[model samples]
Target: MIAIVDCNSFYVSCERLFKPHLNGKPVGVMSNNDGCVIALSNELKALGVKMGTPAHYLKEQVARGEITLFSSNYELYGDISTRVQAVLEEFSAGIDPYSIDECWVNFDGFAPGQLEDHARELRRQVKQYTGIPVSIGVAPTRTLAKVANRASKKIEGFGGVCVLYPDSPQTKGLLQRFELGDVWGVGRRLAEKLGNMGINTAWDLRNQNAKEIRRRFSVTLERTVLELQETPAIEMIGMDFARERIMTSRSFGRLTNDKGEIREAIRQHAQRSAEKLRKQGSLCRAVLVFLRTNPHRQDLAQHNPSMIIELNNPTDDSREIVAAAIQVLERLHAPNKRYMNGGVMLMDICERGTEQLSLLGTQQSDAERQRSEKLMGVMDELNQKMGRGTVRIGTPSAGAAWHLRCAHRSPRYTTRWEEIPPVRL
Candidate 1:
């Protein structure tokens, strides 16, 4: 059987893990740049603070003590997620971490009754270890397990675990109540098509002929529905090996008309992206740099220019990537234009060992590559031990007009010593 485990109010739970006083209080976590509300606690939801509502729009409510808001604290959340995943790893033979707060576990053994007990135990262990509550859904298929999980949230005494066995009467009732859109693979467009055909419920779609569904839709969609009707066909497994891509970007803290500042911003982004490339054991063959003016201010002159540069060789070396990024930045920069934001994107990534040699020119010597690797290694280690920007390129500081305005950001309570949040007795 496949079991889907999802953490409840994940961000709020993470905050409460360190600050217990927030327990049962209205809380919400903001999105990147603290622009909008992303995660809301039960209390916050009850207070009518909807998700995605901009922080600026909620100023009045916040002033009235209707809700507590927090900037996105990824460092704290990432640490807590790791703890939660570690607890999950102990229960199942294999686990597929779906996202920050969700995972799918393969429970190959144990009967129906045993599965229930296993689910309860998993929840208790995770909560005990991480102080985070989770809901578990067990079924023959992943889709049914998801539905069972959502249903479990409303029921009491389930201990956050719900199992839907195909042979049980509850399974049929659950299928009847589930909407097509609620199913895993059914998207809005497919759901609308199904609604038009009167296949509005999971039971309705399940009862349809697989051959007919295949003829109406594609083979893939038909297979998904058939799997949902019986048992989940997808296995809980690790992600497939594929090339990675890194896009690093940031907006200037203030708009500037200086060409030097624009170049500096792009160079900083490129350096950051190259650092990430080295960390991931990959090299880039191409880099893209772009600059843009503020889109919201329609009355202002807007100029968005971008350029892509091909590298002489595939390299994870920050120096090479930064050089190529600056070349593109030079071409895209406009004189006397106030640029609001700029970024660098590294692409055509390949493993360092598997990099193809140049056909027209001599390949880099082993000693040269080794020296470059060693330098990058030391740079990364120093940056991690200290803070980011501690060992940055000189160009990043040349025209430092573009910086983040994180005036109200909470300290890196878990990751950095100087930024740790203080606890009160």
Candidate 2:
């Protein structure tokens, strides 16, 4: 059996964690740059405040005090996610962290009949330890686990836990009632196609000919059909691990055409990517930089260009990566173009110890590599102690025009000492 756990309204819940008074109120969490709603509480949803609604469009409602808003505090959310995952780790050894707010646990060791009880216990512990509410679903396959999870939350009286056993009457009834689009991995396009064939419910899709579905659509759809029939089709593969290439990018707080600020942003991105690479014990053989103007700003001359620099040797050293990234940025940047955002991508990654160096003059020497590693290690330690950016290759220019707009961010209650909740005298 497998169980999937998902946090309920994670960002909004995290905000409510430190501010209990906000519970039961309509609240929405904004994405970066305070642009749009990324998460909303139950109350907010009932008020018809649709997800992805732009902040500027809600000015009247906000001014009328009808809805409360918050900027995305990723640091706080990330720390809370870590705590929740740690509590879950105590439950099972076969854990696959599906996302920041979701995890799948293989319950092979637990008895089939006891799965529901174990899920309840998990919910209770997670709430007690992290103050985040979660819904759990248990089934014979991961796809059904996802379906059960939604049912647990949506079905009245389910009490935040649902289980669908193989060859069960209850499972069949639920599948017949649930919509096909709600099934895992079924998007709008597939749903439309399925609907054209009179397959509007999960049970209809499950009952379709599996090989016919594969031939008509894709092997993935066939796998989904099999899983819905209570046959496991997917296995957890490298859960919570780095991808082949790592990229970090963001829109600027405001539009700017300045080259220096653009370089700084690219450098910061390259530095962050290198840190991630080292953390994953990998090295990159290429660095790419790209920048673009805000498409919405039609008044400005727009330009978007990207360039890649391939290294003779792979390395995780930030200095090396930043140098190559800057060269690409220079090539990509054009004068008179109003740039809005830029970022760095590290590709062609390989395990650190497996790097093959060219037997030529350009290869980094052993002494140089050791020196670079030591420097980055110390920098990382200092930043971890004093907070990020305490030690950077070149500090992001103060009051840079491209700084993110986070006007309503909450205190870093969990990660920073000064931001910790104060006690009454």
Candidate 3:
């Protein structure tokens, strides 16, 4: 059997791990620049505070201490997620991470009857070790496992564990009542399309012929249909680990029309994107730079511009990528337009050694290629060994205007030495 364990309200749960008093309170974690609600606790959901609700709307509640909000603390969340995965690894044969807060555990050797009890103990161990509450759903397929996981979280009687066999009456009942949209991989859009076809419930969709669904819609939908009938169509991991395109973007701490500020942000994004490409063993042939003015600022004149520049040859070198990004910036940046964000995208990427090189002099020579590779390797190694940004191109300014605005961020408790939680005397 396959099982999925998803942490309940992951970000808020992480924040609550260190602050136990906030366990049952309304809490949320804000997006970059305190933009909006990205994660909310059950209490906050009960208060009708949905994801993506602007943070400014809840200012009064924040001040009154009715609801607490924190900026996204990715470092703390990542560390806590690692801890949870480690605990899960001990219970399962192996694990396939679905996201930061979810993992699919392997239960190959365990008997069918013991699955529920083993999953319950796994959840307990995760909570005991990492202080994070998780819900587990075990079933024959990943899609049904996801459905079971949802039930574990939504239905309290299961006590955070649910097991479903294909022929079980419980599975049939749940499938009958569950909406089509709630099925794994079938969002509101696809659900609406299926609803038009009279497939409004999981049971209804499962009854349709898999080949007919594929002919009407997609191969993915066909797989979903099969998975619903207790067939495992989806792989534990998605198609591939390598990304076809890489993008790095973030909002500025404060809006500015300064060309230098725009340049710096684009440069940083380009450098980061290059790092990702190298880490994935890929190379890009083009760089895309985009600059945006705050769309919400209705009072100001707006200019959103973007441009793409083709490199002489595909490369994963930071210098080439950043230079191309700056070149695009020179063309895309506009005068007297207050910019709020910028991004760098590496496009037309391929596995590192697969592309054909150009014969033109614009491409790097043999010696130059060796030098660039060595330099980037050392830079990445130093950054990995010491800390990020240990070896960077150009001078980096700590108090830059383009930096992210995370005023409400909690400490990096697990990752940073100085930010560890204090003990009472």
Please provide TM-scores, in order, for all candidate models, with all chains considered together.
0.89, 0.94, 0.91
Highest lDDT among the candidates is held by which one? 3
C-alpha lDDT values of all predictions: 0.81, 0.89, 0.90
Candidate 1 has an lDDT of 0.81
Name the 10 consecutive residues with the lowest summed lDDT in model 1.
Answer: 234-243
| Candidate 1 lDDT over residue span 196-247, tens digit each | 9999988888888888999989876777777777655565445434446789
Please tell me which predicted candidate would have the highest TM-score against the true structure. 2
Off by over 4 Å in 3: 196-198, 236-240, 296-299, 358-368, 385-387
lDDT of 3 by residue, 19-102 (tens): 889988999999988989999998999999999999999999999999999999987898899899999998789998889999
Using lDDT as the yardstick, the better of models 2 and 3 is 3
TM-score between model 1 and native: 0.89
Q: Which candidate would rank higher by TM-score, 1 or 2? A: 2
Candidate 2 segments exceeding 4 Å error: 240-242, 361-364, 381-387
TM-score of 2: 0.94
What tens-digit string does per-residue lDDT give for candidate 2 at 82-201?
A: 899889988775678888899887788888788889889989999999999999999999999999999999997789999888888989988999898899999999999999999999
